[model samples]
Target chain A: MILKKLFSRRKEEYWWMTIAVPLVAILLALITGVIFIKATGRSPLKAYKLLFGSSGLFPSPYWKNHFAEMLLSSSMFISTGLAFSIAFKGGLFSIGAEGQFIVGGIVAAYFGYAEPFAGLPTILHLIIIFIMAMAAGGIWGAIAGWLKTKKGIHEVITTIMLNWIALYLIEDWLVTGPMKANISTGISGTPYISATAKLPNILPGTRLNISFIIIAAAVFFTWFLLYRTTIGFEIRAMGYTLVFGMEAPKASGVNVNRRIIQTMFISGAVASLGGSFIVLGILFQYPPVFEGGYGFDGIAVALIGQNEPVGIFLAGILIGALRTGATSVQLAHIPKTFPSIIEGLIVAFIALQELIRYLIMKLIVPKRSKSD
Target chain B: MDNTSLLNSSLTQTMDYAAPILFAALGGVMSENAGVFNIALEGIMRFAAFFGVWGAYISGTPWIGLLWGIGIGIVIGSLHAYITVKWAGDQIVSGVAINVMSMGIITYLLELIFKTTGYSPPVPYFGSSVNRIHIVFIENIPFLGAFSNLTILVWFAIILTVLMHFMLYRTVFGLRIRSVGENPYAAETLGINVVRIKWFAVIMGSIFAAFGGMALSLGTLSSFTNAMANGKGFIGLAAMIFGKWTPFGAMAASLLFASAQVIQLLLQVAASGFAKLIPLGFYLALPYILTIGALIGVVGRAVPPAADGEPYKKE
Candidate 1:
């Protein structure tokens, strides 16, 4: 009788299990963090207290500041994560987001710092930079897309290599060439964006800017595109089945090559747009390290979110909070890398947790006959 | 071209630039043949470059220090294997993890061990000069003599290529390893210990990757620097892919990419005053641009191994 009841609840419990897995992963990561703290000769409780205590991450003022900063950072992460997720969902790995992101910043910065037309207003300048940056990233991304579709070049290998090209190109041009900072010797960065191009702060004296609203708009647009558009449907179809036989489209009859290329183009544009936000909104200038490790972190965000837009946003916030709080821990005398270790543990657990659940099910679930 | 200029150009330009990538590409072939996706080649090489110089500096023997790099490569490569192969984890993630770990470890150790960050303590005679072999036959041959000032390692690379070609096509073990990559299930059904063979192939590749790293630090640069491997590992992967996963193909790709690198360096040197106009970021990005262009020309027609990144387990 209990078995019957449990079997009846199984369908509903599946959703619960999905939630349970991340919860379990988080719990396991915390446990691992304790071990890590002890191994490093720090008090785990003290560290935990600092992270969870008053004036740390959880209280009202701290929470507000933390949430606002995390939201700002999460907006950037989600944009890039969406870029990766869309490509991964379509069965293509766009590891070149880093390159696209950099190009976007370069293009945006080039425009932002350049002399505006005699009659053009600051808002117009901002718009031009945004549009140019997105277009530049899109074009950069499209090269790989075009190659993938026409020549069947794998995106993974191409993107990784392109990242280097982008890096060296930026460093060389910014440090020595036309855009080289005339004020600083041997430094590779452009001049600060025009004051008119700067993103207005939502709150006084904080880094949060108008870019957060743009990120929200982007999320909504992506969600709408994925769920409501004919092209999005075609892209998803092509993603599911690349080919069944030679020289022909399979079911849904979408042109697989065109869809793949288009998806990559959009992916690249989104990533580049994120870069523009960081440059125009946050940093106000393009520095080498300003690009940060957002690209790889996007992969983690995508995985955690299961490639869903809302899930991705939430995951990015969680990651951003961890990042912000992690620095606070460092100030509290703990090593700075503890957060990354925690994140690695979370990813490892999430990746492997399904296998563990399967084993438990196989061992514990009773076999039933159809005749019964 | 005159024989002397050709010889000088090949000696001073081509082979000098090609060694590290060629070694790394060869390692990729071995790993791919055994069904291991060797994206960690860059991380492995970087780790070796840093640690090899550290070892040489501490132990006072460059050769012994180079061997210590090989040891570190094996340890880290095996850790990658454990995560991706044994744990059934994602290969890309594992590769990324290895890269992140390598960057962190090298930076931390450089700070901890040498009390220096970004660069290492300079060891005397570290990768400074090379001895060339000039034979009467070089004068006799038209094109071959231009590459006369070839380092000992460059010769080893060419010999390794010939040896690899022989082993891959001629040996029974090579055939088995190839089969394992192609169809591990079928190979397993036929009594091959797929797991063990893969582990061996991976470890062997690690040794080569280590040598590539050592070559970077000990043969090219006198002291180690953080992120020194740059994107050589990825460039090597491009070579492997562009070479259609064959040793000769990889060598050709490596040489082509290295030639581009040499050209970029030469251009940078020749026009240092006009550097800003050149868009150096784009120049440093030449290998990627060229590789993509080349791959786009040929990738659609080629085929990789059936189970390149898929982990296998005996159910």
Candidate 2:
């Protein structure tokens, strides 16, 4: 009876925790941004007003172009964020998400323009693109996973290597060479994908499209897979090896090696879907230069969101808003890079959050608490 | 095909590319040798490259810039050590945090100082002709001519490799350092101060990485771009693994990777016909492809230092 009560209470605690981590991080980031602006001899309030329109703070101005950009990017961020969170849950540091994202985009772009699966129904065409792109990403991710499980090679190094490989082979070479649009305009990018393959805009007068709905499904699918399945149980069991030292999981009959590869495959597929979203929903074509650091942003988002699927969805929107605000910081006569400083600071703070909380409680709050 | 010129370029330019990678790889060797999972070499190099340029621009000396780079490396390294070592935090998280912070912080400072986001102003740098140690007589020699007219930084890399090899393999203190990396508890029992060794190793690792950053800005380009030290640090990390975590082994691996890079350029320029028939991406992606292949089979299970990324705590 006591054990049941304890388990039930633990479940309840996560509801509050889902909100707390991002709240504290966002709060700390805003405070730091304010100090930085103040140090530069500018009114923090004025700069912020120019930053987030209707700067009253709930991430507003949904009718504007910026809000549309934020919503679109949030969809992208949430997708990649799911990738990282799933991989982390399986005890893999999969930085290959960037590469997987790129691969997925290219593969989707290829299928988007290619006529091999042509004349099919629109929904069928979309399904084919999703499968092909996600499979490409999965295969790419599995390389690193296989290296880790079979050869004891570090996944981080291999994944980084794979990222560079994708950059050179796919992004730089193939896209600019064979896949280049034949238009005499001399632009270096893949041909525009078919209109039938493109996701129709859902939000009238804004770029927001079917990606918003699709990404929501992805989050729900990942949450269900992680929390409501036996495979997820095995994956979580492997993850706990970080604390239990790899022995408990091994002894508990979890196939550690298989779990690593499976988890990374799922992670890679999700990241690739992010690429598909951009290609299908936003760009409708693969450009020569996609410096979208969405994969890296996923790392920050996953950490800030405490790795819950729903939490990641919220964190993605928050970060996407910051990114939109950053692009417009120039109107306030502040450098756009300023918002990036806050993003980086938030990551840095979370990495050492334990120490920060300790310092605050002991150094700043002790006197007031003692009086109470 | 201009075969001789291609061969000459590949042989000579190898060290030029290899020198920075060698410096960064040695940095990996130092820190991981002490069991600190220091993957912040890329971030440290980024910071140092910019600071070095600023220092040189102000003082009109690459040497002073190098000093500034070292100073910042010390601060960054100490920050890393504090979080991962002193605080017993997650090593990967700390490293990732530092890497993330460096990207924004450097860009912010670059805009603040230079009033430009693209690249810094050209400054006094060792890569200039006046500073190079020209081995004039070697020009008459066949392959040996490739080593002529190199920067002092290149020589530093070569010398440091030898010194690291000797220190790591031939000394008692080196044994203790390796022992700590392998098992800090065992080292502590043997009276070695695990924290002190870790501190020394992590700090020195940063200093070496700072030198690599200097090689990029102060040695090669004489100016720091926002893209300075692009992926060199990670390549160095790959070199450390490919070398099986030894000084001389890392030097060899750096040379091989550098040669691959040089061959790509040679193929692009000299073998244009071949380049067109195939694709430029094949050459550009060669090094990374080679890394994946090497990790898969050639190296055959390169194990890290036993206690590599663990945050050790005393009982």
Candidate 3:
């Protein structure tokens, strides 16, 4: 009877465990940070005070300026996160996000600066740039996806390789080709875009602009497509298992594999939009380093968010805060690398959260009686 | 048709350029055969390249530099083995972490030690002058003349290929290693120490991958750069996969990609009237594009080892 009762309780417990685990993990990280601070001879309390305390709190003028930078940072991350989330949900780990983002960014830079159609209206130019970026990123992503789907090429290998190709292509393009800037300096980047193509700021002094709004729309659309559509359902279903029989989606007359391809394509398109946003909204030029590691960070963001849209939005903000606050903490004498350390720990903790919980349950729960 | 001249020149460049990838791909084959997905080959190569060149700069000897490169690879590979194999961490994530961490470590170390971001300029480094092979008889032979003079390591790789072929396909230990890859559970039941084999494969793989990096830093470039391994690790992985995971096949695949790269370079040089139409951007992406294309083109499946990335546990 106790066993049955315990079993029944598990369902309820699990509902809470899902939320509790990630939250608890963050708490663990913060506590660990305390230990780190103590070891460094700084008061843990003082460090925390500076890291996320009242002065660093958002909405104030000082916080406002930093918050804008965070948005710019998270703007790229959110787009990449959405990209990872989309493909991951469809049972594909598109590790080529870095490559796709770079290709997209470089191509968009070309469009933004090198076109004879520079005299076009701002909105039209933006549309053209967005389309080109999306196409470039999509094509890059589709190569990996196509390789996986067609040749059984493990995407993990192909995507990583494609990243190198993307890097070289960008570097080579910037140095001696169509998009080369006319500077004598030994830097690899394109000429700056026409002013009209740049994202105008909402707050005038801040970097927060049309790109943030575009990313917001993309997130909303991703949520709608994933949860509220038949296509999403099919894609998610295919991801669950390949063994199809009586209970298969084919029984419901839906083609699951097709949905998988469609979803990845959409994922690529969304990620590409992020590349466009970065170029059009902020950077205004394609520097090799501008690709950064946003796509890589996106994977961590998606995981921590548990692949939910609202969760992603909140997680994006949390990550934004870390990116923002890490600098503040550094300015206050804490190590600047702490944020990355925390980020790494959070990802590790979450990825292994299930196993940890299972271990805990095994330890805490008593053995069943013979009668039960 | 003067096919001899083209073949002769292409052969020489392939040996020089393909050496790094050949070593790395061979290592990948061993690790994959032993059921460990060695995706951190890129990072391993980079770490080795950086440290290998640094050691040369500090120790004033290329041999010591090469050994240091190998040692660095062993440490990085062991960490990869411990985390992914022992802790059962996600292989992909761990591999990426190693890559990221190595990049930071190398960057920081470069700044602290060398006070530079990437390239350490060519110091007075020394390695075996196996840079040229003067096989007197072959040097006098008709079309085979130019092929005689190549790096000694090129010959070493060819011999190693045969040696590996015998070791992997002919020996009892090789059979056990293959069994471990096919099914660790069955191998364990049959009394093979699967964990030990995996560790052996990873460490051995690391040593070879390190040599690949050394080839870049010591053999080809005579210097080190940040992220110097570039995509050679991925190229090695591609070669491994494209070759269907066989040692010889993988070597051939590595050569194919390396040759594609050489061709791309040559095409850039000989950008004649018609060749000018091909954008340098597109041409540069040829090798990777072909890797993707090759993956799609091959109809017969290239299956990975059954337990390729899965950590074994005795349940």
Which number leads on lDDT? 2
Tell me how far the alpha carbon of residue A118 in candidate 3 is from the true structure, in angstroms, after superposition.
6.2
Compose the digit string of candidate 3's lDDT tens values, residues A1-372.
642432343365545565665676677667765775676566777666666642234555477666677776677778888888888777776766777777778778888886685888888888888888888788778777776666677766677778877877677755356677776745557778888788778766777887777888888888788778988777676655442321466677766445655666777777777777787777888875553677777777777777766556656766767766665565555554456556655655554554556755675444533335
Q: After TM-score superposition, what is the CA distance of residue B86 in candidate 2 from its true location, in Å?
A: 2.7
Q: Give the TM-score of candidate 2.
A: 0.91
Residue ranges of candidate 3 with Cα displaced over 4 Å: A1-61, A110-132, A147-196, A242-257, A287-292, A297-372, B1-10, B121-160, B293-299
lDDT of 1 by residue, B48-110 (tens): 888788888988767667778889989977876676666666666666556654654566467
Residue-wise lDDT of candidate 2 within B115-198, one digit each (tens)?
888699999899898988888877646687767878899989999999998888899989988998999999999899999999
In the range A1-372, model 2's lDDT, one tens digit per residue, is: 642432342354223433444467677878988998787666788778777773223555553666677778888889888999899988787878888999999999999988776567778899999999999999889888888889888787798888888989986688978898887956569987887788778878878888878889999999789888999877877776754556788897878888889898999999999899899888888999887678877887787666778778887888777777776676665777676677766766666655665555566566867898
- Model 3 scores what on Cα lDDT? 0.72
lDDT string for model 1 (A1-372, tens) is 643442243354344455555666668877977886676566888877665542224675566666567667777788788888788766677877788888888888888888753235877887888888988888878878887777777677778877777777777666356776665455457877778888878967567888878877887787677767987776666555543322333454767777777888888898898889888887777885554667767877776665766667767777676776666665555655456656656665665554646654565444423335
Report the Cα lDDT for residue B237, model 1.
77
Ranking of models by lDDT: 2, 1, 3
lDDT score for residue A60 of model 3: 53
Interface RMSD of 1: 3.1
Candidates in order, TM-scores: namely: 0.84, 0.91, 0.80
